[model samples]
Target: MLLNQVPVFIFLIILSICEAKQLLDEEFGTDDVTSGLCDDFFHGTPWPLPHDSKGRGLARLCQNQIEDGKEGRIVFATMFSTTERIPVYTANTVVLHRDGKEHPRPGSKYWYRVSLALCSSDDHTFDPIESMIGHAEKHEMEQCRKFQAVTEDYTHNGLNLDRGHLSPNSINEQDLEKQLGTFTLTNAAPQFADFNREVWRVYECVAQHTILDYVPGEKVYIITGTHGVALDVNNNPWWMNGDDTDMDKNPVKIPGVYWKAFCYPGNKTHSAWGYAIVQKNENVYRKPDYNEYITLKEFNTRGIITAPFGPSCMDASFGVFSKVFENWDEYIDTKCPSYTKKKREEL
Candidate 1:
């Protein structure tokens, strides 16, 4: 019996060593391992379900009526149909705010964009429904008319910015209904054509590909929005195109920067690996790179995200996959040559 017990002890010791090594790997740098996990950030708070004054949680193309003090509110749009009835797309909607005609600032905790999910499995294939596109346009027109009647604000047309969809159509390519839902003007915001088509487009593709490759079967939650005062080429805040007197005639506001955050919850090993990326909405073309990724702590510190992203659905350790790049040292050297040289000399 003692001899048999010795083998069990040996096995336990080996297992402990392996676990320790993995932890060390995460601590130092390991792209595949989960490095950060902050589960207590939410403090038992529940996810905010989308709703409006009328208690209508889900509306196709309607805008939520903002209360006098309330700057913004979220309203659900559509859900992705999955085989398991998992309801993978709750809180998958837009956050509307009131402010300017070219750029809008959502009040604290309000998303000036949309958040949603996409699920794909080996057996499932997503395809867009061409017919639904027309239907979606009709809904937008009707909703715009209703908005005009209630607020008398100008419609979302005749702007220099493109009607960029917060929840992009490409994300829901697997489901026709979800794809169509993205077309609603309510789900869009004014965006510079160059920024939208160039910088932002690349980032979106990288984000989508990262999830698909890392967690093939699980659902990925993507929260996207805009923030900050729009900037002119000279880096000054670009307010309404014309004087404030005519501002009421147009209410759309352009954004200075666009942001996206994503989380893959099924990776139990690295459940805290949430990430957020921000790109300037300008014409200067820069390809999406890993350096753009920042930790959730850094994101909050920079004032990019002010809301409490908690209750563990999004976790606390949200940020970039820090260990993915092999030349981090070299990259830093190039950016800060003096600093790198100083550190190396001291070492």
Candidate 2:
């Protein structure tokens, strides 16, 4: 009986090892088999390649919902010094809060960018992910090719708007690939220099620190995006100079407001918190007002932007843990008073 049981135990061990290898392959795209596994794992089928109508390979998250009326097609970025390959993981690994899209009318391209990754406290050094920018470049090149427009035409040159990152690099510092993934132009929107450098910049730092402090060593998802119309220095809506016929002449849409929301999936106490800042993309130089901080629900309700998580994620009570830090003002005052003080001094 003992001899018979030994064979069964050995078989079980072998099976476990095989499964472990398969999982690793699926996660890393080690080989063709792993590539197929990733496709099946994400799409649950192998019929259609993950390319969009433009023949660009969409990211796994974007591919999963191509049929769901998402606007812009997906484009995967290659690692800077490594071979070209798409990343694969379970949905819980990185949540694509919104898919990229090209909005109709005004011909203004509105790139919807937001995603989240779970962080491990073991490593905290934030490294730049150059691939994120590569993917964005690839996507922009595809768009340029479609219109027979030179790559320079797609640049926001002479527009006085800076290429702002919707999903900032600081949040995913733990993972090199994901950090690089944030560099893509697909994740960027045109932003006013003053707003981007002053107001939004400070909020980003506060949000990141809040996450690291509150959910230390836990799984946290950060979702961020931009919306609304861009304004000129005179507080007037800005549009491309030419008629809206060709992609070359089209102006990159500038968001009137930028928002960020973060969630701690591991937290049973509260779900998520979010805030929005309104910057008309003008020439004004001032720090963002911390008084603008609002609950995730209010931000969405007022802005008409969809919540990163479904509506259920919003806690109306504005509970203690809802905003990560108990007092937004206090946190800004204590943690980094310099951000606020410097703004006042400039004024």
Question: Model-by-model lDDT, in order?
Answer: 0.43, 0.42
lDDT of 1: 0.43
The ten-residue window of minimal lDDT in model 1 covers 49-58
Those runs of model 2 whose alpha carbons end farther than 4 Å from true positions after fitting are 1-156, 233-236, 240-250, 265-280, 316-347
Q: Candidate 2 — what's its lDDT?
A: 0.42
Clashing pairs counted in every model: 12, 8
**lDDT at position 58, candidate 1:** 18
> Model 1, range 280-306, lDDT digits (tens) per residue?
766555654667886555655555434
Q: Please provide, for model 2 over 299-330, each residue's C-alpha lDDT reduced to its tens digit, 9 standing for 90 to 100.
A: 55653333444444454333434454447667
TM-score of 2: 0.51
Model 1, C-alpha of 204: deviation from truth (Å): 0.6
In model 1, where do residues sit more than 4 Å from their true spots?
Answer: 1-160, 233-249, 267-270, 304-308, 311-347
Please provide TM-scores, in order, for all candidate models, with all chains considered together.
0.49, 0.51
